[model samples]
Structure formats: C-alpha cells, structure tokens
Target: MAKEKIVLAYSGGLDTSVILKWLKETYDAEIIAFTADIGQKDELDGLEEKALATGASKIYIDDLRAEFAKDFINPMFQAGALYEGQYLLGTSIARPLIAKRMVEIARAEGATAIAHGATGKGNDQVRFELTAAALAPELSVIAPWRLEQFREEFPGRAEMIAYAEKHNIPVTASAAKPYSTDRNLLHISFESGMLEDPWFDAAADDNKGMYVLSVAPEDAPDQAEYIELEFAAGDCVAINGTKLSPLEVMETLNEIGGKHGIGRVDMVENRFVGMKSRGVYETPGGTILFTAHRKMESLTMDRDVMHLRDSLITKYASLVYNGFWFAPERLAIQALVSESQKNVSGTVRLKLYKGNVMGAGVKSPVSLYNPDIATMEADPTKAYDQGDATGFIRLNALRLKVGSGVEQNAKK
Candidate 1:
C-alpha cells in the first residue's frame, strides 16, 4: 500500500516550513511543497532547495508574475476595489490565483488533500479554502493551525522552533519579529505583532525599517513629476505614451512612484470575522492607477452612470475584501463594472510629489465636458431658459412653504 500524498502551499516562511516537516511526520504522507512567484522578486531565491531539505517529497515553484498582474491585479484596479477605502486588496487578490494553481497541481500529482499555514484567526483561511472549495471541493483541506492536535503539539512560534530543532530540521527560528508582512508585485502589507496596538503610530521613527517598496515621504524628491497614463477599457495599458505589457506597466509605475514616495496607507479595518485589525500598506503603482482611472471616468462617464457605479463601489470593495471572489453576487457586480468601462478609454496626467497623487488633467474621446455651454460668455445662439427659474423654485419649495404657513397660523 502506498502512502497518501498531500500538497501544501509553501512560502518557505517560518510557519510553512515548520508545517511542511510537521505534516510529513504526523501524517506519514508524501508532502509536496508549492510556491507561487507573484513578483516577490528575491523571495523565491533558493526556495526549491529549502523545500526539499525541509522534507518535501517534491518542490514546485511556478512563476505566475505576468498572469497575476494582468488577470488579478489589473481587474481589481479597474474596479477601484479598495477595502475600507484604504487597503488596495493586494493580499486579498493574490490568494485565489495561488489557490487555483494549488488545485491544478493537486490534480496533476494525484493528491487527495491540500494544506495551508494560515492561522485560524486570519482572513487567509477563508481566502484559501473558499478558493479550493470553489474549484475542488472533493479534496480535503488540512489546516494545521486549526487542528487541536497540532495546536497542542506546537503551541506557538517558540514551540514550533523547539520541535524543528529537535527534529534536526534546518530553520531560521529565533524570536518572531514585531510584525507580519505579505508581499506581491501589487503591494506589500504589514500587520500583527507590535501593530496590534492601534494607538501605536506605524509612522514612528523606530518602525522605518519595515518599509520595503519605498522610502519615507520626507526623503522623497523635492520636485514634483508628471506622468501620463493611457487606459483602454479602464485598464492602464501605457505610460508616457509608450505601450507596454501589463507587468511591465506596473513595474515601470512602481519604480517611478516609489522614487517619489507616492503610496503609503495605515488604517484599522473591520475584518470579515467581526473584529478590527490595523495594517500598514505600500501600493505605489496601485495608487497611481486609482487616481488616474477616476480622473478619466470623471471626464468620460455620464453623471448618472458614474453615480450608479459609485453607489456600488463600497459593496464591490467589500466583496473582494471578504474573500468572495467566486461568489455569484460579485460576478454580477463585476459584469456591471465591466460594462461601465466601455467608454472609459482616455489619458490622464497626474502629478506625483512626496506622498501625494493628484490629477493634473484628463481627456477622453467620449468626454462629456463641454466648456462651450458652461462658459460665462453670453451667446444668443445658445438656448437660455432664465424665465423658468421662478416656477422651478416655487414647485420645489411648495411643501416647505406650506409647512411654514401652517406653523405661522398656529403661532398667530
């Protein structure tokens, strides 16, 4: 009889590394470690050798950078999906794509189960398992952090470190750091550990070392720089008039925006589990995209159409934040969002200075802005209806006037 095989989403991080070894020992199963490279540039270095040495029967490292930026990041950017008006949904967007690939590998390797290192408390458990369920509900999800036996075996990071040392498993286990971070091409997030104290300012001088993508705003260039972004159907396709691939566009914008310290946000957001958590994020390229896209929409979109989309923006953002990427309601909203972008082709010029992103100008072929009709210069050819103001105002104020008269009569 053969041992059962289990596929694990491995990050080569402390938690996943320990989980890889623990799964092998506890289940006596062949554990295959898989890592997705979604533009975590140097993070993928030596991952294969590390996974193999950590008791993985096989190691799979897939470079999904281009696909991740194009299919996942771009669509969320198009929808302007910001969780709680602060987070750019960077980690939220990457999870489903990674889990999708995990299922594909599970089917390929004939694995009966899949596992992840997401703690029982976090939103990732929902993100990872919901994706797995949507794609392959037949495969069992093995979350060690939620398992009582595993929790008792290794109570915390310190216990996991002890277990790893006893088993001669190589690890960089010291005291865990003061923050937890997740990184992809779109953004980098910092939370947990010392960040649990909501009053403790993340911008304090001591925490400067935590930022990876950009420098402090005070250290940014003194002069403002302007950049032009071209969008096709609400997706940014070019920068400064030069057409580039989706990944290239993001990489280019990140370099330019990071140099100027463009995107940095800190907020306490409501978790899907009914608690609030503080997180700091850096989303340079995404910030630029959001500002430019909204500016273009202002010029190209009709007033009512824009209002309708704006009304649903919060709900759309919430759906992504809550890990309902595959839900029917999300799909329906996304359909309307896509339809609204049909005439959203345009170029927006923006000024980036320090930590600020502002629209410099916007122009679109379908722009509804008409300076001629709005101008103060009198033109007899234009149809003017000044005399209709009396009736318009009287009709609008009828109820108010009637209520005022009734109050006066009572007073008399």
Candidate 2:
C-alpha cells in the first residue's frame, strides 16, 4: 500500500523544520512542504533547499504578495477592521490566505492531511484550522502542538534544535535568540522572549533588534513630510500622483513611513482561545494608509452611511480578529463595506511627523460639504432665510418641552 501524502505549511523555522521531519518518521508518509511568499523578502532565502534536505518529498513556494495585498489587506483596511482599535489584524488576515492556498495545493498533490506549526496555545492554530474546515471539510488537520507525542519529544525550542542536529537538518535557531517573529508586506510582529513581559519595554537594549521595519520615533527626522494619496472607491490608487500596483503601493508607503517612524504598536490582545498575548508590531505602511483612508471617507461618504459603517466597525473587526475570514457573515459584511465605498473617491493630503499621521486637507469632486451654506461671513445676496429657524427650532424643541412638563406633573 502507498503511504498517505500530507501537505505541511513549512516556514523553515525551528518549529516547522522539526515538524516536517517528525511527521515523516511518525506517519511513514510523504510530506510535501509548502511556503507562501507574502513579501517576506530575504527571509525566503534557502527555504526551498532546507525543506527538501529535511525529508520533504517536494516543495512549493507560491508568490502570494499581490493576492495578499489586493484581496486580504486592502479590503480589511477599507472596512476599518482593527482588532481592539489598535492591532492591524496583520497575522490574523494572513492565515486565511495561507490556508486557502494550502488547501488548493493539497488537492493537487493528492494529500489527505494538512499540518501547521502553530502552537496549541496560540490563535494561529484556530485561524488555520477554521479556514481549513470552512474551505475543505474533507481534509484532516494535523496540529503537532496539541499532540502529546510531539510535545513530550520536543518540549521547547532547545529540544527541537537537538532533534535537528541529530537528524542532520540545517537550522539556525538557538536559545540566545529567545523570541519569535512573523513578517509580511503589511507588518512585522514580535512576541515571546522578553516581549512576554507586558511591563518590559521592547525598545530596551536586548529587545531593540526586533523592530525591523521602522526606526525609533525620537530618532526620526525633525521636519514633517507631506504626501498626497488618491483614492478611487475607497482604494488607494496612487501616492503623490504616481500610480503603482498594490504591492508597490505598500512597499513605497513602508519606506516613506519608516523614515518618519510611523507605525509602532504594543499591546496585550485577547486571543480567540480565551487567553491574552502581548505583541509588538511595526506597521509603517498600514498606519499611513489607515489615516489617509479615514480622512478620504470623511470627505466623500454620506453622513448616515458613515454612521452605519461606524456602528458595524467593531463587529466587522471582531470577525477578522476571531478567525472568521472565511465565514459567511464576514463576506456579507464585506459586501456592505464595499457598497459603502462606491462614492469614497477623493484625495487626502497628510503630514507625517514623528509617528503621527495628520490630514492637512481633503477634497473630492463628489463631496457633500456645501461651503455656501456653511460660510460664516455675511452676504447681502446670501440664500439663507433667518425666518426659517423659528419653525425648525420650535418643532425640534417640542418633545423636550413636553417631557419637562410631564416631569413637573409627576413631581407635583
């Protein structure tokens, strides 16, 4: 009988490297390693060779950068999907994209199961599994962190390193490094190690090396940088009149925002599995885009529509944060978000200075701000009628007056 083939989401990291080898030894199955390239840049170095050398029958490295930006990141940003009004949903949004491709690859490779290196205590496990269940219910998921055999054999990174050495797998992990990081086009995040302490400052000497995307805010340039962003139906199409692809837009903003020390967030967020985890993130590009997008919407969107979208922002944010990217309710909300963006076309001028993004000005051809009626200067030929205010105020005040009278009667 032929051994069952399994697809593994291989990152070539310490934990994933061991999982690849252990899966082969335990199941006597063929492992097809897969890695999604979502703008990890130099981190993809030597990943293919490393995977094959560590018992992978074959490997697939797919470039999902464009797809990640166009489909996942931008849409969430348009909906203002921020977890707890702080986190950009960086890791949470990427999991579904990774899982979707993993399912497709599993089908092509004739694999029966898909495996991931997410620990049992983390939210990635839930995100990966829920997406798998939603997309391909027939396929089985292998979570090594939840398995006692895997956990007992490799209790921590130290044992994993020992296993790699014994098996002759080339790995660069060590106890000295201590913490873990995840990176993509939108942001880079650091967790565990010294970052596990909520009171520990990430900018301290030992942890300073973790920030790869931006400089310290205090170290930024003294002068503010001004940039203009053009949006069409809520999507940023150009910066400073230069049109670029989705990937280029993110990269450009990252470079520009990093120079000004734009995006840095540190918080303890509630995980879906009933636990809290502290993480430090640098999202230079995303911060600039979020500020500009909100400012643009204020110029072009209707007041009631904006209010309705604001009311649903928290629920929409929760859906993405809680691993429901593939859920039907999320799709439904996204449709509403898309509909609300139909008229959100505008240009917003922003000033970036020392980690702050402020809107200098905003304008749209479809703007509802009527300056004629809003102007305070008196005009002899103005369209205003002062007599109209009497009926308007009287009608609006009638309810308040009746309520006051009722309260007086009750007191008497």
Candidate 3:
C-alpha cells in the first residue's frame, strides 16, 4: 500500500504542533512541513528542528519577505486597499503569498494534499484555500479546525496543548496571553484574546506594551519629525532623498514611524466570515506611505483619473479583504489602478507628530497646478475668460432647471 504525502503549514505553535502529529496518526502518511518567513521577526528561530521532532518527515523554511513586499504588499498599497478605511489588510494580504508558496512546495514534494492552521471561523481559512484552489485545483486541502473529528478531539487551546505534550512535541505555549498577533512586513494585527471586547481601552497603560510596531501617542516624543518620500509610478522608491529597495523602505519607515508613534488604529471591523470582530492594528510604515502616495498623486494625477480610481477603492479593498487576491476581477481592478498611477510620480514632505501625519510640501515636474492660470492677478496676454462660466454653468444646470420646473408644475 502506498502512503499519501501531505504538506502541512507548520508554525511550531501549539495548534500546529498538535495538527502535525494528528495528521500523521490519522492519515498514516508522510508529512512535510512548510514555513514562510514573511517578517514574523521573532518566530523563525529553531523551526526546522521543531518540525522534525513533531512528526514531520521533513521541513521547508523559505524566506518570502522580499517577494511578499514586492508582489503582495506593493500592489495592495498601490490600490490604497484598506478594509473599512482603517485596516491596512495586513493579515489578509500575507495569506495569499504563504498559500502560494505552499502549493509550489506541494508539487515539488509530490504531496497529494495541503493543510493549514487557520480556523474555520476566521478569514484566513478562506484565504489559504482560495489561493490553493486558484493555483492547484487538484491538490486536496485539510483544514483540521473545520473538520468535525479534529474539532471534537481538540475543542480548545487547552486540549491542543495536552495533545502536544502527550506526543512529546516541542511547543512554546505557556500561560496564554489575553490576545494573539500575526506579523509580517507591512503590519502586525492583534485580535481575539482581550481585544474581542471592543470597549476595552486599548490606549490604557495596561494594554500599551502589546503593540510591537508603534508606541502610544502620549508616550511619544513631543518633537515632530519630518520625512521626505519619493514615489515612482505609484510606489515609494526612496526615503529622505536616499534610494532604497521595497523591503528597505518598509523597514526604514517602520523604525521612523514607530519612534514618532504613528499608524495605530482601534476599530471593530466586519470580518468576511460574517461577524463583527474588534482588532487593534499597528501599520506605522503603511500609514506613512499611504499618506505620502496620496500627496504625490495630488501633484501629478488628473482630477477625473484620480476620481475614477477612488471610486474603485472600496470595491478593490473588499476583494482583498475577502480573499480574492487571485480572482479575475481583482486583476482587472488592479489594471485600472496601475494605469491611474502612471503619472503619480513625485516627492512629498511629511511631518509626523504623535499619531498624526501632516503633509508639509510637494514637488513634481509633471505637476498640473498651473500657478499662472490659477493666479488672482491680471493676465493681459493670456487673460482668463470669466465669461466662459456663463455657458458652462447654463449647460450643467439644464437638467436641474427642468427638474425644478417639473416639481413646481406638479405642485400647481
């Protein structure tokens, strides 16, 4: 009899540890573990040894940070995709890349099925599975949390810890914290534990130390810091007059934005799984870039083109948030967004003070702000025609005039 090979997304955590052993016992198969290092800054240490000890036949620890920034984060940033205008889609954006690499690994490993640690109730389960379905429909997906048997065996975190201990799997689970977090290059999201209560004062000192990316506004330095951002074709290419790669730009901004206590949001967002979930996000670098990019657009982008792109923001954001990053419609929307940003090249100076981002100045060679045409002073040679407004106003008001007349006649 031939045993099936399964590739599991392992994190060396309690849930994944238990799932690793359980998959082996249940399937009687060869288990291959895969880990994607998308800037989970602290979680990558000693993962390979941990996976093999926990019943995985082998392990794959690939660094996907650079690809994550260039492919996933940049396109989302260019679209200005923010779920509910607050969340930067940090957690949502990272899942696709992770799943993408998993599918590739499955093919190389000759694995018949792929598995993830995402629970059924959250958006991640959909994100991981959707990407797999889009990329490799032939591969089977094993979501343990969604299965009746797996859920019945380990109903909660406590049961999962017990299972890991009984199996002699190395796990770092201890006295559980009130909240859980997911981190990547763009942002870190804290949810579930204490944050489930939307009324909890996250700004209080008790909750202050939970955030990794930014500091509390009140605790930040009183002095304001200025930073200059340069953009090319809608992507930030440099900072403070220095050219940098995409990864370097994010790292630099996270540092500077963290020092000044920027990019912190506490909001209750609508989860794609049809529930209201409260989350506190720290997107310091993303917040700065989003602001600086818009400032750059104001200098070079036309009003109608910008407006058209703006109209697509919410829909585009919804698609990303809902795990459709690989969908045809999302690609179509991105085409429109990319075309709109072709002229959005410039430099914007910003002042970061506490939690606020202020635009200081902007410069662009292709700036559409013609000072001569907008001047209040008289221009004899190319004088602006005030009389042009008469016909322009009349033509635009024609529909309104007819509508008003119809209303008055109906009253009579």
Best by lDDT: 2
Question: How high is each candidate's TM-score?
Answer: 0.94, 0.95, 0.97
Tens digit of lDDT per residue, candidate 3, span 209-252? 88888888888889999999999998899999999989998989
Model 1 bad stretches (over 4 Å): 379-412
| Residue pairs with clashing backbones, model 3 | 178-193
What tens-digit string does per-residue lDDT give for candidate 1 at 1-412? Answer: 8888999999987889999998998999999999999988888888988899889999889989899988888777767787777888988999988999999999999999999999898889998998899889999999999999999988877888887788667667644467888989888999988889989888778877788888788889999999999988888889999998889988998888888887899999898877888999998988888889989888888789788888887898888777878778888988888888889998999999998998899998888887766667874547556677799999999999999999999999
Q: Rank the candidates by lDDT, best first.
A: 2, 3, 1
**Model 2 misplaced regions, further than 4 Å:** 379-412
Scored by CA lDDT, what does every candidate get?
Answer: 0.87, 0.91, 0.89
**Best of the two (2, 3) by TM-score:** 3
TM-score, cand. 2 vs. native: 0.95
**What is the Å distance of residue 129 in model 1 from its true position?**
1.1
C-alpha lDDT of candidate 2 relative to the true structure = 0.91
Q: Write the per-residue lDDT of candidate 2 for residues 1-412, one digit (tens) a residue.
A: 8899999999998889999999999999999999999989999999999999999999999999999999999999989888898999888889999999999999998899999999989989998999999999999999999999999998877788899999999989766766888999999998999778899888876565668999888888999999999999999999999998888889999999999888999999998899999999999999999999999998788899889988888998888878899999999989999999998898999999998999899999989777876677764557787789999999999999999999999999
Candidate 3, overall lDDT? 0.89
Clashing pairs in 1: none
**Backbone clash numbers for all candidates listed:** 0, 0, 1
